[model samples]
Target chain A: MSLDTRPPRQTPVRHVATPRERDEQRGLPTRSLLLALVLACITLMVVDRTSGEDSPVEPVRRVVGEVLGPAEAGVNAVLGPVLGLPEMLRTNDALREEIAAQDDEIAELRREAHQNPYDVARAEDLRALCAMATNTGYLLAPARFSGYSSAQSFSSTISIDAGADAGIRPDMTVVNGDGLVGRVLEVTSHTSTVLLIVDADSTVGGKLGESLESGFVDGRGGLADGDPLDLRLVDNTVLPEQGQQVVTWGSEGTGPYVAGIPIGEVSKVYEDIRAGTYRAVLEPYVDFTSLGDLAVVVPTGEDTRVIEPEACS
Target chain B: MRGNSRLVAALLIVVTALLVQVTVLPHLAWNGVVPDLVLLSVVGAALVTDPRFATLLGFGAGLLLDVAPPADHAAGRWALALLVVGYVVARLAHDYQAAQPGPQPASTPRPPYLLMLVAGAGGAFVGTSLFALTGLLLQDPAVGVGALLEVVLAAVAYDALVAAVAVPLVVWVFRREPAPRVAHVLR
Candidate 1:
């Protein structure tokens, strides 16, 4: 619609105009325009849904992420302290008390560390992650949490600072210090989207940590923050108890998820009467609400180290 | 000059709202749902702008929300949702204006708070429901019925609550422009 630039008049017109007359005179959005826009959107959605991995929408999304990722990070950095002001104030007194208590504890810990010093420099979370990596023998590239999916209510995903530039690719397993966070869904030059395990549509191969009873862990889509996941075991007769640890069963090539990463512990168990199936609830180890540092696992291909026979020599 | 200023103001408002929606609002979310700030901004703009402009604004904002990072759903879902929101809100405002008994003053009046509140709640209800419904139809493993109901209700309430402040801010930004109909009549 063209902008109508009316000259200022000497007096204001007092006549009331009908809605149709007003719309016509102003040349406002007509039915055709609205329909066309709606059609465009439908077409976009159709193309996006049917195209899967290589959708035309992927390039648009990647450019948007590359452009907006740093901007959002900058805004977050500026607003972080301001946003945390309330929590900081609430904990001020507790922090003061802890400072005094921590001094003594720090001194004791430092003395103990001095006696058996070996790689105590890493943060606690990173140390745990390193331990997990060593135990699993997978290559890990660390990433920082930057932003979250805008449709938080409907789906669950998070953007990290590391991406293709860091050798991160789609379907790589993402884990935190505690347990599995999710798998990489999309990757740009410097950012990637990780579909959290708490998302409604996510299903991971999980099994009982001890008994090795395998099941599928389904995410309940409502809450993005540590929502309870539903576990459906393959064996109907395996009556699982509460507090049993659940871990990933691992994928074939370890592209999606690696084996033995702690998922959560069973909180409740019930039997589906009609289906005659057993179900358990798992409370995840990772805290979704406060997700910060994460590590994306890149599996190293088959071990090629040559083994020499020392005893023969 | 007036058109340029209006365009810049609207752009600033929508971009800021979109930025905050993705960055900060997640932290302040209640019940795991953040208020739809972009929707509220479109509602605010619709109150003052022409219907054509409002519809376009809605489509653009929705498209941004759809393509922005971490949005795993289909690309056009939000674009469709917000397009409807903008059209509905603009037409409602136009009808309300037409129903008024006398000619409006030359100066643009403040946007009606009740209307904004209604638009916010209604727009949010429609937008989120449409987006979620489309997700389900696509077999995207959408939330259950109970969860969908909870989301729709929470989004409506939250958007309405935020509209109280956000709508006025947007209306204030667009206040410099002459009311579209009034300008058309004067010309």
Candidate 2:
């Protein structure tokens, strides 16, 4: 048959498929929709970055917090024992030591109780926090951690169960039985978010208890990596020895971090050759992984100007 | 009705993953990094859903994670990251199925476990890298660059491990129903 004349030898499959076929060939993905969603995400990030406190996303975040806060609390309560298993495993030795020490103290207390019948009252919990509050004359609001910052986040933050209703406010110092846990980042009606001292974004002025060497202590933000806090001394010449205690050097108006709250202990001191600076690594006293009860320093409206600066001895 | 049920199932999985990631995963972290369950959920959804739905699912899951309490990064970082993951994963899976020699039955056969794993790990690496890069560009990186790299590596491995378990479960649930959409593509 002549090329064009044999019943129009059915033209080789043209491959000129219809629009629907083309879509099927590509697996039915609407490229425009994907692009739109991507652009929307970029817009959101830009807005959230530039808007600061007033970002429209804030309300949505708040609403999520409002909805999830109680649910998290419920889940936390249910999972409390399971969650403590790891901490318990880690602190097994320390806890054993504490029990032995407490045994002797308990025996001594029993003898004392035998001598004086009226002295049977138990000591209060969170003695360090209460004592520090008493010593510094700062009013304290007690709270518990409701939830932690999402694992996916880079910042170390915690949601406390107390907030404006409990007189907790942003930038207030939060402490636990061990030492400084973090500072209140923001507050809602009944909950507050604390920015942990171990976050890379957080920097607190700290002083060596013995040498009085002051430095800026910032988190390595690698709590997951078991990284310690880095203390960059203002006086690069003075090298702090290992085991030196670090404490907050106090912030202006006693906000964010108060003076004298123990921060950490110098674990290792090293010099950076490139920067020509000596840096100390600190092991923070607070067991951030197992943070439980915490207290926020609420200003008592007392004459703070009269209160003397007290070292958290 | 089938489509709506599938959407609900995907939403349920993502939300549940988010709650667990934030509430329980921290205590289970190894060396300070926890598995990104929400991102894995997006991968799982992508495997079983159309690319369009997968992309949207990724954005929604990412937004929920971004705005979820304890999420301090820019609101859209995760959203953007997961959006890329969802679209890429679904597109790849779709094309893969489309290239198969015969007409796909109504009951879609599961993609090989190895393919699922590779897809999951790839999605995780892309999503995490994007999230970290955005953090750097925004000048609000949670850790130093060195530490951030470590986190990204740990996150990918952890996510892949969890996805091995979780993605199969998601695929089983979504694929149990005769997927008319997928069957239509093969025809």
Candidate 3:
């Protein structure tokens, strides 16, 4: 009826919705959503990269790590009993064997002491060396073994329980009964990581006992057939033979690692045609694989005088 | 039923795993390789929990691992990496379930869940690599890719083993209750 009076009124028709449109409506925005996601990702990467280098996170990590400490201690403690069951069965037999070995060793030492008093004097000297090294006012902090990397891709290293809180500093020397384990490379509040001498990047100044021949001991990663460790003699002048002892020269005046701490005995020496230097592999006196406890040598500045220029020469 | 209990349990599990890894595992190393028990526990927890809870758990577990021993990399890297892993795994699971949509018929068997296993193992690999990479970038260049891969593989194997056993237990523990049935009787 209205059409008779005027043109029919036009109403705007709404567009039909597609499934894709519905999906889009239900989901996040394309451009905005992508922008948000990209921002988040960038933030995360930045956080990760920064976190990798930042030291301030140490305390937070330490607190979180406390959760594992007791549990780990409990597990380790319980494992002792669990492992002891088998050892208990073999106790008597092991005791007998150990006693015999000790007796033989004692007899050999006694014979050496009687025949060559110098051997006894050398033993006394080593003991004195260890004592003097310990007394150098270097704050010795005890550390428990934490973890180790089995990957041949990196250097051989072990984590310790002590950290910066215990005054363990980076580049500080680590030693066991035998000699140098490595140096502290990183420190947290409650833990520290030691880079072992067997690591590919590890370098130390060492000398032979008989010839006073000096050279550098360099780590070659993934020793042939993974024979624990390999050390390259960087100098051709000093030829290290198998069974000769190697000790830190302490030329750097770092008394944490004393001059005569036994590092390892030369296991093998071979002349390299390509390098023209003798490649001598060392089996470290400290069996890193079985290391349970360690001592971190804190620089006290007291023993700085021990490694005088005259003595190092 | 309380959330705190679950948190405490998770904490306990992680701590125990760390201790075992450091102390006993060294003695039990096979050709210098030790099983990553902490990684295994983290993956198992992430698989069964919500994303937020998984992230929290992962962060906590990672922190414990970072602190437990020879400190290599800086703190929080592991925590951050694990949080992401937990979130990713949870999201993937949600997407998978949403796609499948429906209760199984009585005659139907469950589908193979190998993808979830792979994801878990892959997460562990990523976590370890990030740890090594972070350490190298920050402190020393000695962290080698070969060694990082070895750790990743070891962690994956260990995580897989734990998942194989722990997944069923987790499923049983956290299984949802069936909806109530309404019966219509025809007289």
Candidate 4:
């Protein structure tokens, strides 16, 4: 068929003002021009603050994060090793003493290794069962620390080099071999931001190691303050002792944090008559200052990080 | 300088400061007091540019940081804080310039280094104090008052140091086109 050649019906023209025209409109009120911008910012702050995890700007933030996250991850990977040298040097003496102790333990373990092949196999099976029982609800994803918040003294968070691509999402509990680190706060395609447990706003449900008394633990956002987290117990009957370990009371699977992850040890305890809670200082197992790698707790039955527990490994 | 050139220069300064702040500055944190390169740049921009433009630029830069990864507070807190800082610094610069006369063509003669340092210190203090206060109102205070005060002092000192190097360079980049002498009006 011959191509239909005809003057196209005139499309209705809409007058969209050009950017230059808009700029030339000097009649625009300053009250709305600049004041409105600041006012809008304030409005957004209130909305975001009040909305918590379900904030409206989350999708926009995720898009921006996806674009920037990989680049940040690349830069951190290149720089982290070099930047960590001084800290390594500072801890050399301590490591040497620990290495000596580890050497003695290794010699004993080696001696035991030769004794019983049957017993060793049985022990391996038992260890696997223990790990299975302990981490039954967890599907963990490993991530590397990419960057930290640039604000001085006003924030404490780290960006990890893993995200939706690795089954990570906002509010997933994070941990290390030692204990609980924090949780995923915001996630992008290839990266996620983690709010450390030492941040002022972070709160978690924690249980005492021995007594099993449970309550809330809050972060103090201490950066260089030796102690930065606190725990509170509201049970008037149970008394908490110093050096007792605190662990998370695993939250809902899709909630902000997962359970059974160690939080810290109680360093100090004070009685609060009015609040009916005992406030205790926490000395965290993982140092917030020198974060390297962390793992996000994904729910079981999902694809997870290929990490074997220490007992099994 | 032409407005276009000035705009490019200002943007370049902000981006470079951001890159360095995130990548290199972390290693330099001394007792948690890392220098605020972005705040220094805003102060420097205000010292040379128009107040309105500086204020808007501050808002934009602050917004970029507020949303960037690792940011924990609400989205607009930094923007509001920096908006005020930029406006104050720009007004101070304008007033300072009004008090002095110079014969330099195309560009105003440099203000006293001490003046730039003072503006930097003031902006740093105000910017950090606002960040903390707004965070407090948001119920997400990253630190307590004792820590905030230490930060404000540390920021002032660090901004002064950064301004010594950054201000003159920014002044050169954003230098205004020369204008014929016009009589001042005193209301």
User: How much is the lDDT of residue B144 in candidate 1?
Assistant: 88
lDDT of 2 by residue, A56-140 (tens): 9999999999987787787889898986777767577899898999999999989887867432211233455566666666667
Candidate topping DockQ: 1
Best by TM-score: 1
Report DockQ per prediction, comma-separated: 0.49, 0.43, 0.10, 0.21
Flag regions of model 2 displaced more than 4 Å. Answer: A1-16, A19-21, A24-27, A81-313, B178-187
Tens-digit lDDT track for model 1 on B34-138?
Answer: 999999899888887767788888999899888888688898898998888888888888778768889876544676778878877888888888888888887
Q: How well is each residue in A1-313 modelled by candidate 4, as lDDT tens digits?
A: 8998887869866778876555334122244556887897799899988998999867767776776567677787888888878767757778888999999999898878866775665455345333533464455566777888876757788899999988887888877646788888899999998888889998899999888888888988866876788887758657789999998887676568777777889998888788666778889988677665566777655665544444343
Candidate models: Cα lDDT each = 0.82, 0.82, 0.62, 0.75
- Model 1, residue B183: distance off in Å is 19
Per-residue lDDT of model 3, residues B1-187, tens digit only: 1266557667766766676668887887765666666666666556555555666677667655555655455445566566566656655654565477677334212224675467657766766666666566554446577876676677667766555655444433333322221122222
Q: Rank the candidates by DockQ, best first.
A: 1, 2, 4, 3
User: Going through the candidates in order, what is the number of backbone clashes in each?
Assistant: 1, 2, 6, 1
Candidate 3's DockQ: 0.10
Query: What is the Cα-based lDDT of residue A237 in candidate 1?
Result: 83
Please give the lDDT score for candidate 1. Answer: 0.82
TM-score of each candidate structure, all chains considered together: 0.51, 0.51, 0.40, 0.45
Task: Arrange candidates by TM-score, descending.
Answer: 1, 2, 4, 3
Candidate 3 Cα deviation (angstroms), residue B49: 2.3
